[model samples]
Target chain A: MSEVLVIVPVYNEAASVLRSTLEGLRPLNHDILLVDDGSSDPVPELVSDLATTVVRHTLNLGQGAALQTGMEYARREGYRFAVHFDADGQHPPEAVDALLDEMQRGEADVVFGSRFIRADNRALIPSFRRGILILGKVFNGLSTGVWMTDAHIGLRAMNRRAIQCINLRENRMAYATELLWQLRHHGLSWKEIPVAVVYTAYSRRKGQSSWNALRIATDILLRLIYR
Target chain B: MTPIQLLLFAALGAIALIYLKLVRYQLGAVVLLGLVLLTGCIAVYAPDLTTLVANRLGVERGTDLLLYTTVIFLCGIFAVVYGRFRKIEEEHTVLFREISLLQEQVRRGGAAT
Candidate 1:
C-alpha cells in the first residue's frame, strides 16, 4: 500500500483546530500535514504539539497556495498519495479509508468524495446547498464535458503522478475550478464516490455565495477562451 | 430647440463622459452609451413625444435633465474608485501579515543555529 498523507489547510479556524481533527486522525497511521495559512491564533504551536507535521504560512495566501504548499511537501517527503482535507469539520475523517481503498484498487487516479452521488449517504446534505451543488455539476459538465456529479467537493485524493501533472496557479477559491480544468485538459482518469458532508454553521459561513459562483463561471470561461 | 431636446443632449454627453472615466465593465458601458444615443436621436427626430413628456414633467428643457444625470454618473464613478481603494487596502493587509511571518521565521532561525 502507498503511504497516505492527508493535507489539511486551515485559516482562522481556532475553534476547531487541533481538537476534533487531530483526535479523529490519531488512529490512522497515515502522515498528516497541516498547513496553517497565516492563522491569527497559535495554531502552528498547537498543531506541532500533536503527532501531525505542521507547516506555517506567514500570512493567509488562500486555499490554493496552502494546498500547493502541502502537496509540494508530500512530493518532497516521498508520499505515495496526498488527500486534500478541509480544516472545517465537514469532511469526516472516517471516509479517508474509503478514498484510499478506491485508490489502492486502481479504480481511479483521483477520487472525489462527491456529496451528489446517488448513494444512501446523499440525505446527509442540506437541500439548499444540494441545489447549488446540482447547478455546479451541470455547469462543470457543460464546461468540461466530463459529466462530473460534483465539482466543488473538497474531500479528494490525488496520487503523486496526478498531483505532479496538475499545476494549480489560482491563489483564491477558484483554484478548484482550475484543478478540474487541468484534469480535463490533460485527460486524466478520475472517479467520484458518495461521502457524507457535515455542514456546520462554520462551514456554511465559509461556503461560496451565488454571486461568487457566477464569478467563478465567468473566470473559467475567460480562462478557457484565452488559453 | 425645445427644452426637452436640450436636456436629452446634455444627458447623453454626461453619460458618455462618465462611461469613459469610471466603469470597468466596458461592454455594459458601451451598451448604455448606445441606449443614450438612441434616446437622444429619438428626442431630436421625434419632437412631439419629447415635448409632451417634458411638458408633463414640468422641465424647461431636456438639457437640464441631462445635467442632473451627468452629476449622478460622476457620483457613480467616484463610488467605483472608492471601492477599488477598499479592495487594495484588504490586499495590503494580507501582504503585511505574510511579511511579518517571514521576518519572525528568519529571527528564530538565526537564534537556533
Candidate 2:
C-alpha cells in the first residue's frame, strides 16, 4: 500500500460528528491531518483525543489556505499520496477506500469522487444548489478542458507529484478552479469515480451561493488571462 | 450692476479660467483673459441682455458655478483614493505570497536536516 495521508480542513463545524468520522477511517493505514482553520470553538482540543496530526491556522484563512497547509505538511513528511477529506461530514468513510483503490490501480495521478458519475438518484441535494452544480460543470469544462459531471466534490486523492504542481493562491472557493486548471496546465492524468453525497443542513448552510460561484468563475477567467 | 449679477459673472470667469488652466491648455489662460475682457464690455454696454440671459439660464448669483466646481473636485479626490487603495491591496498580496514561500522553504529545510 502507498504511504497515504488524509488531510481534513475544518472550520467552525463544531456541531458535526468529527470524532465519529475519524473513527470510521481507522481501518485505512493512512496518517490523518486535521487542519483547524481558526475555529472559535474547542474543536482542536476535542479532536486531540483522536489519533491524527492537528495543525492550527493562526487566523481564519479560507478552505483553500487550509488545504494548502495540509498538502505542504504532507509533502514535507514524505508521504507518497494524500487525500482531501471534508470536515462537514458530507463524504462517507467507505468512499475513501474506493478512492484509494483507484489510486492503487495506477489509473491516474488524481481521482475525484464525483456524485453524478453514474448515480441516477440525488435526493439529498436541494434544487437551487443542484442548478448551481450544473452551472459549475459547464464552467469547469470551459476552464479546464475536461468534461466532469460534478466539479466541486471535496473528496479527492492526489499523489505528491500532482500536489507539488498545483499553485493554490486563490484562498477561497476559487481553489477548486485553480486545482482543475493546474491539472490541465500540467497535463496530469486524472479520473472521476462515482460516490454518494450526504447533504446535511450544515453543509447546505456552508455551501456556495450563486453570487459566490459567479465570483469564482470570474476569478478563474482572470487567472487564465494573467497566468 | 447688482451684487448677484457681479458675483455670477466673476464665478463664471473663475470656472472657465480654472478649467482652461488645468485641463485644456497653457495657452487657454490668454483665451480666458480675452473672454473676461469681452464679458466686461458686454456687462458695461448691454447689461440688460446679459442679466436676462443669466437669469433665464438659472445662473442665479454664483450658486451654479460653486456647485459645479465642488462636484469636479470631489470626483478627482475619489479617483486618487481608489487608486491608492488598489495599490495597497496588491502590495499586501505580494508580501503574503512571499512569506508563504519562505515558510515552505523553512519547513523543507527542517525536514532535510
Candidate 3:
C-alpha cells in the first residue's frame, strides 16, 4: 500500500483532460484523492471507477477549500505524505518521485515544486504570466513577511507532520498565501524542488489568468487586515 | 417643476426601482433606501445639513465628514460581505464532511454485508 497520497483539486475540468492526467499518474504508486469543487459538469462521474477517492463539495467553495478537504482526508487515512497535484495536464507525473524524495530526505517537512527554479522542460511560460507570478510572490511576501520562489505553483509535497501542524482556512485563491503563513506560524521547515512543468496547448488555454493574480493579492491583503 | 428637477426625480425613481428589485435582504434594502435618501438630501441640501452636522461634529467642512463617513461605511460593507461568505463557507464544509462520512460508512457497511 502506498503511504503517500496525491490530492487533485479540480473544478469543472473536461473529463478527457482530467482522465488523461489521472491515467498518467498511474505509475506513481500512491493513493489519489480527487476533490471535485462543486463542478457543474460530470467530473466526479467520469473518474468514479479510477483507483481514487472522489470527494464532492455540495457548493462551489473554490480551489483552496478543495485542497484542504483532500489533505484532511489524506492525513486521517494514515498517509505518511500528500502531494498537491493539479488536475490540469500541466505538471509532469514523473516529477512526483523528485517531490517525494525531498520529503524522505528528513531535512524539510514541506517541498514545493518551483518551475522558475527549473527550466529543463519545454514549458512555455509567457512573459506576462511570469510577471504575474512575481507580483503574486511580492503580494504573498507582503502578507506573511516570507518570500519564496513559485509561491503560486500548485504542485507541492507535504509530509504528515506538515499537514498535521498546518490549518488551512482560506476558501479561495488566497489559500496560496495562507499556506505560506501557516508554514511560518508553525515554524515548519520547507524546501523548493526544481520541477519542470509540462506546458501544453490545453494548459495555455486553461489556468489562472493575470486578473486572478491581482484578485489573489486583494484577497490576501483583505485577510491580513481583517484576520 | 423644472425640466432638470423632473429628470433628477426620474433618475432617482429608476434607481429606487432597480434597488427594490435587486436587493434580496429586506434590512439591506431598507438601509440602501435610507442611504439613497441621505445622499439625495446631501446633494440637494448640502449647505443646511453640512452646516448643522459640521457644527455638531466640530468638523471644518461637511464634505470631509461625508468622505470619512463614506470610507467607514464602505469598510463596514466589506466586513459584512466577507463575514457572510466565511459563514457560508464553513457551513458548506460541515455539510461536505457529513456527506463524506456517510459515504464512507455506507461503503464499509456494504463490504460487511
Candidate 4:
C-alpha cells in the first residue's frame, strides 16, 4: 500500500461515475479509502474490486462527517499523508499529483487545491458559482482569519500532523470554514495549488445551492456561540 | 378566582409539573422552578400585589411584567435546548465514527492497518 491515502467521501453517487473516478486515480498508485456516507445507490459495491477499502456509515451523516471518518481512518491506519478527493468527479484526479508534490516539498503541512490560484482555472468556474465563492472567501476570512483563494474546495492534501490535529465538528456544509479555523488554531502551514474543477450537469445537480450559504453562515454563528 | 385566572393557574400548574418531572435531578433547575412557581402563583391570585411590585420596578402592570419576563425566560430555554441538541449530535457522530472504523477493521479480518 502507498503511504499516501486518497480519501474519497461518497454519498449517493452513480456507480459509473465512481468507477471512472477510481480508474483515474489508479494511475497515481495510492491507497484509496472510500467513506460511504450511507449512500443508497451502492456505488462503492460496484467498484469493490478496485483495491480500495470501504467504510460504511449506517445513517447519512453530512459530508463533513464523511470526511472526518476518512481522516480518522488515515490516522488510525498509520498513513503518512492523506488527500481529500471528491467522489463526484469534479476534482481532477491528476491534480492529486500537484497536491502530493507540493506536500512533499516539506514546507507546508497542508496544500489546498485552488481554482482561483491560476487565471485559466478561474475562467472555468460558472459566473453564478464564482460570485458565491467570492462571498464565501470574504466571510471565511473574517471568521477564520485565514483567507484562501477558494473557500470550500474539497481537494486538499494533509500531512500526518495536520491529519492528527484537524478534528471536524461540523457535520454539514459549515465544515469548510471549520477546517480553515482549525488551520489557524493548530498553527499548521498551508499553501494553495492551482487545480481545475470539471462542472458537469451531474456535479452541478449534486453541488451546493445558493440557499446553503445562509445555512452555513448560521451554522458558523451557532458554533461560535456554542463553543 | 376569575375564569382567566383559573385558566392561567391550570397552565402554570402543568408547566411546573412538567418541569418538576424533567429536572428532578438538577438542583439549579429545581430552585428555578420553585421561584417561577411562586411568581406564577402570585401573578394568578394576587394581581394587586404583583402590580404593587411592578410599580416599584417602574412597570405599567403586573401582567405586562409577567409577559416581558416570560418572553426572556422562553428565549433562554430555547438556547439551552438548542445547545443540548447540538451536544447530543456531536456524541452521536463520535459513536457513529467508532462503529464505522470498527466495522472496517472487522472486514479486514482485524488486521492492523
Chain B TM-scores, listed for every candidate in order, come to: 0.56, 0.47, 0.64, 0.82
Candidate 4 residue runs with Cα over 4 Å from true position: B2-14, B56-58, B110-113
Q: Over 4 Å off in model 3, which ranges?
A: A121-123, B1-53, B56-81
**Cα lDDT tens digits for candidate 1, A1-227:** 23899988888885554568777876877888787787888575666557666677777877876787777767666788999998777888988888889988987888888887766567777777677777877887777777777778878998878877776655566677788878887777899988888887877877666557777777577556544
**How close is every model to the real structure, measured as TM-score?**
0.65, 0.67, 0.78, 0.94
- Candidate 4: tens digits of C-alpha lDDT, residues A47-133: 868888999998899999999999999999899999999988898899998899988999899999998988899999999889989
Q: Report the error of model 2 at residue B12, Å.
A: 23
Over B28-75, each residue of candidate 4 has an lDDT whose tens digit, in order, gives 988888887888888788888888888899998987887888899999
lDDT for B82 (candidate 1): 64
User: Pairs clashing in candidate 4?
Assistant: none
- Report how far off residue B27 is in candidate 2 (Å): 29
How many Å off is the CA of B41 in candidate 2?
29
- Summarize candidate 3's per-residue lDDT along B32-89 as a digit string, tens digits: 7978666764555444676578769988877777778779988988889888886786
- lDDT by residue for model 3 (A1-227), tens: 58989999888898899999999998878888888888898465798788777777777878898898887787677889989999998999988889998779898989998878756531457778887887787777877877888888889999999989876777888898999999998999888988777767787777877788778877787777666
Best by lDDT: 4
Give residue A88's error in model 3 in angstroms.
0.9
User: How well is each residue in B27-73 modelled by candidate 2, as lDDT tens digits?
Assistant: 66667557656765575455666657667777764445445546996
Cα shift from native, residue B68, model 1 (Å): 23
Where is model 1 chain A poorest over a 10-residue stretch in terms of lDDT? A218-227
Worst 10 residues of 3 chain A by lDDT: A118-127
